[model samples]
Each structure stands twice: as structure tokens, then as C-alpha cells.
Target: METMIGLPFTPKVLIVDDKPYDVKILEMKLREVGCQVAIATDGLSAIEETRKFKPHLVLLDIRLPDIDGYEVCKRLKNDADLKEIPVLFISAYGDVTDKVRGFESGAVDYISKPYEFEEIFARVKTHLMLRSLQIQLEEQNKRLEMLVEEKTKELVEVNKKLAMLDATKNELLQLVANDLRTPLTGLFSVLDSLIYEELKDQLTKDQLKAYDKAKQQMLSTLEDALLLTQIDVSNTDRVYGEIPIQQVIKQALNNVRPIATSKSVSIVECEAKDFKIFGDQNLLTRAFTALFEIAIRFSARHERIQLQLGTFDHHIELSVYVIGYTIPPDYIGTFFDLSSSARLNILGGELGIKPAIVHRIIALNGGSISVKNEGPAGVLFIIKFPFI
Candidate 1:
């Protein structure tokens, strides 16, 4: 007898036969090849031992004293738990009709007796190998199902944490805007009352100009804070439609003309064909106004700022060229970041949050904005929007 190697486990076999001499010989042959054997002398005892041993394969003899082997196979096939165990019939009847009956009763294979021991061992090895492969496949499927379930649970937890963080950020922005705007409104009313003809005559020319400048700065700060809060909290409620790019630029230039005139800065515009894009018209005007204000604030007296417009492929591009001041190298990367007040300090005023707000508005409308230093000329701001 040869020992089997590389099987998944030791095969368990049950021998069902009344002949003691044949059973003894077959049991010895199976044990030599690393099989665990259980013996049953009749059909009734075969069924009982099969349940207790839970064997991988069964070898049955048809001519038992009690119930026949064909009937025993039928009973095992009817059972939900035992139906998958492979059964082979070893009997004295070798006719074709007898073989058919054994297969119809759920026997996997048939062998006629007065049989050679070598042939019996060969058939037994084949069925045991097949049973081992079936068990291995079932275990692999169970492990794969468990892995998929674990990953799905992890994704659900991550999405829940992200939703909570977004809500907290919105609440904080609203609180800051409300707290600062209340005091600034009261101070603005006091300044307006001082502009009467009687009160104005008592002040010198320089004194009245300083008071006007202070009032303007306070009003601009209040407007920026309120708009920032609205963008963060209710930006989803916007009316989208087709907008003319030339019209949007005209509106922005008109809004910032007073500030540019006060600084003695000249805005030079290039004539180009009008282009159209899909977005909220009011929001685009606000974003462009902020960009022009920043350019005017950084320019020297009598310096020229240029606005150029062109089209490339399916996108419309707008470039704002400020000709006097270039951004410092260290602050270029974080120029549009929310916490970039240190960079704005170099410009002698605070304009950090305005850039962040412009970036958000552009992204919400499916556009993009970027700034780069243009060396001796100044800094260039480029904005692109899809026209289709």
C-alpha cells in the first residue's frame, strides 16, 4: 500500500458490508494510505455510523441481511445534511441493469465484486481527492464574503464623520459675521449725522477727508463679512443661466471705478469678441469686482492695470495684469488660502479672506482661477470658464 501526500486532510471512509473477511482486508488497505475507517455490518447500522462518523466517502455492499444497499443510498440522498457525501457501491452483481439501479439511488460510482484489491483502492482514492477539493472551495468563498462586508462598514463610518465637520464650520462663520456687523452699523449712523452743513463748516478740509475715509473703510469691512457668511451657509440657492462675459466685466468695472479713481489708477481694457458662459450672473460680477479691487489697492499712483480677454478651445480666458507690484516668493503658494493674513500685511491692509471667497465662487460655477508672478511687470491673475 502507498501513502497519499499533499491532500487537504486525512480522508474519512465508512465500509458497509456483512462479510467479515472482505471488510477486514479493505480496512487494512485504506488505513495504510492515511484514511480513517468506520465499520457497519448492515444497512441500518451503516446509516447510524455514517451520521456519527461524518465520513467524507461511503463504500456499500448490496447484499446485506437487513435493508439493501440501494435503499440505504436513497435514504442518505434524502437527508439534507448527508446528501453531499460521495457513495460507491461494491457488490457481487455486475450486470448493466444493476449498475443503473445503483446510480439512480444516488451512488457516485459502481464496482462489481470478486473484485481486485488494486481496482478498489484506485476508485477509493479518486473519490477521496474530489471530496477534499470541494471542501476547500467552500471555505474560500466564506472568507471572501467576510472581507467585502468589513470594507463596506468602514466607508459608512467615514462619510458620517465628514458630514458632522461640515455642519460645525458653517455655524462658526455665521456667529463671527453677526457679532462684528452689529457694532459697525451703529458707528456708520453716527458718522452720517456729522455730515450736515452746519457741522461740516466747523471742520477743516483735511479733517473732513480723514472722517470720510474712515467711514468708507468701515462700510467695506461690514459688506465683506456679510457676503462671506452667505457664501458659506446658503450658496446652494443660486439661479443659473447663460451670461454674457462682456456684460459681467462691465458691471464689475463700474462697481470698482470709485476706488480706482480715488487712487489715481488707470484701468486699460482690450477690445475683444464677447463670449458666453453658464453661471449665476450676480455671483460672477462679485468675484470679478473683488479681483479688480485688489489690483487697484496694490498699484502705485498713475500706474496702468490691463484687462485682456480671449478664447482657447472650448474655454474663455480672462487675465488681469497689475503693473506695479509683484507678490513675494514665499507667499505665492498660499496667496488664496483662508489663513493667509500674514501675506496681506505686506500690502498694508487685510485682503486675505477676499481671495479665498473668490476661489470658492469660481469653483462652485465650474471655473478655475490661478495667480502667478510675472517678474518685473507684476503679478497676473488668470481665470477660465467653459463656454459650452
Candidate 2:
């Protein structure tokens, strides 16, 4: 065969045979076909010549003056640096066993004693061409792997920048929500005073109800905004302590009494055992307040709002229920999601933080929350907490 494309560098051949005549014939033929040839009379010298010459191919005879061709081929293939140099066995022993042994010894193929130069040239050309393609493929794979690693690093940096931007936006939102709190507080104070003063006689029952509802909704918005700031923890890291659920409930009820009175909705603390859990008391108090506020706003006029606290499966179970409104079953699925609150038409006394902030506070305390609608009868908000 004529010269063909197989390697980036000039091909070199190492002929391992003790017969001077055999070595001379192969050396002349390989050189004529544009291959640089190196000679080794024994297996020991063949390995040495391969190292020095770094030939692209090796032409080995089965019988060497010292080590056999099988051992030489095995040694060449075992070496990480030399294994890619294709070894072709050339021997006078042309039995099936000899051919099998040659291949088992890592020879690419075996050639008979009275070898045809055309067969030699064809096998060498094919193996060398295959070897060159394997090397190119490995190089391409390494480059692809490196490219994937670089892209992964770039994605990590982008995520870090996005997180920083989110933190900045939350900070700005906290500032705005804080500024709105004071005026809403003042609005409630004035309304409460008016309904109790001499002007109380001048205001009709419906007008007083309107003022109360307005005050309650405004306060709900204020609390939501306030809770938004607390959600991220400001001085919250080291202030945890034991909090009695009863004490928290008492505070929430006291804060909610006026709203309940205005709506003519009655509230009662049902049968519950006293228990304590570890958490941030002030935050938990605000969380309970949000729960009560939601209950009061949702309860029908003159309806009963029942709150119960008990233990269940090593957990503190707190449930609030209103006698008539049935929360849609599908709404229960998104009950704790913040988007649900955000989508509410808040003017109808619906708060924009009910399950969102309420669930977050309980979750941060290592607890979980769930909701259920007892159709045609009532809706329940159940909050469970683990003892710290």
C-alpha cells in the first residue's frame, strides 16, 4: 500500500528480529514507503529502541535471540507511554495457536513466516490510521470536559449576584414598610377614642362598625409589613427562650378583642392543656396575633370563633376555627404560599399575610401548618410546634 494519512508526525517503525537477513529486508521496504525504521535483534534491545525512537509502530518476530515476541509485545502494551505504539507480530510459526497467542500478547495482528510485503504494508497502514483517530478523539473529549467545567463556574457566579440583588431589594422594602406603620397606629388610636367619647352618641351603629372595620384592616396591613421585616431576622439569632402557648394566646386574644366586639363575633378559648415550647416569644406573639386577626376578620357577624391548644404525637397542636366560612379545597393547597396572600383583595378585611407569615414563623420554629375546610360548617387553621 502507498503512504496514507494516519499521524500528525512522521511514522517510525521498529523491527525486532534476530535474523540479519529478515531485518535487512523489512528495514529496506519500510524505509522505501516513507517510514523511518529502527532495528533491535532481541526483545531487551527492542524495548530500548522503542523508548529511544518512540516509533509509531512495532514489527516483532515471534522468536527473538533472548525474550520471545509475546513477552516483548506484552511489555510494550503494558507501558502507559508505549502502549499506543501498534505491535504487529511477524513469525515463521503460522499455526492457529500462534496467531491466538500473538493477539493475546497485545499484537494488533499476526503475519506468517513467508510474509507478503503487501499484507505487511496494509495491516500497518490500517492500525496506524486507527491509532491516530483514537488520539484525536481523546484530545477532543478533554477539551469538551474543560469547557463544561468553565460553564459550571460561570453559573455559580451568576447565582451569587442574583442573591445579593434580592437581599438589597428586601432591605429597601423593610424601610418603606416601617415608615407606614406609625400613621396606621395613629389611625386606630383615634378611632378607638372617638367610639368611646361623647361623640360616640352622635355616631350611628353602622358608622361605628365602618370605623372599626377600617381600623382593623389598616392595622392588618401594618402588621403584615412589620412582620415582613422580622422574617429576615433583626437581632433574632440569640434571643430564643421557652414560651408558654397559653400566654401567647392570651396576648393575641387581648389584641383582637376590640375587632371581635365591633364585628359582633364571639371568641372563646376551648379545652386545652397548658404547654411550653422554645422559640422567640415576641415573634411568636406577633404570629399568633396575625392568626387571631385572620380569624376575627373571616368570622361571620355574631358567629363564634373557637381557639384550642393541645398535644398530639409529641407536638403542640393549636387550631382556630370560625363557624360558617368554608375555605375552598383548592385554596388549601396554596394556603401557605405568599402569593396567595398577595392576590387577596385586602379591603374586604382579607389580610395579605395570613398563611404566608404565619406559616414562616411556625416553620422557622421547627413546626408545620395545615388548613382544612369543614364544608357548610367551618374552616380550620391548625398549627403544630415541636418542643425545643
Q: Best candidate, TM-score-wise?
A: 1
lDDT of 2 at 331: 68
> How does model 2 fare in lDDT?
0.81
Residues 1-388 of candidate 2 have per-residue lDDT tens digits of 4774546767788899999998898888888878898899999999999999998889999897789999999999899999988899998999999999899989888889797899998888888788778778889999999999999999999988987877777777787778777776786678678676957899899998787767766676666866775686355453688888888888988988987898899998966566988887877887888788778766888999988888888888988988766665666687678777432643243666666888888777677888787668687888898865
The lDDT of model 1 is 0.85
Candidate 1 residue-wise lDDT at 32 = 85
Best by lDDT: 1
Q: What is the per-residue lDDT of model 1 for residues 60-154, given as tens digits with 9 covering 90 to 100? A: 99999999999999999998889999999999999999999999999999999888878888888888888888888878888888877887788
Model 1 residue runs over 4 Å out of place are 1-151, 191-219
Give residue 207's lDDT in candidate 2 (0 to 100).
90
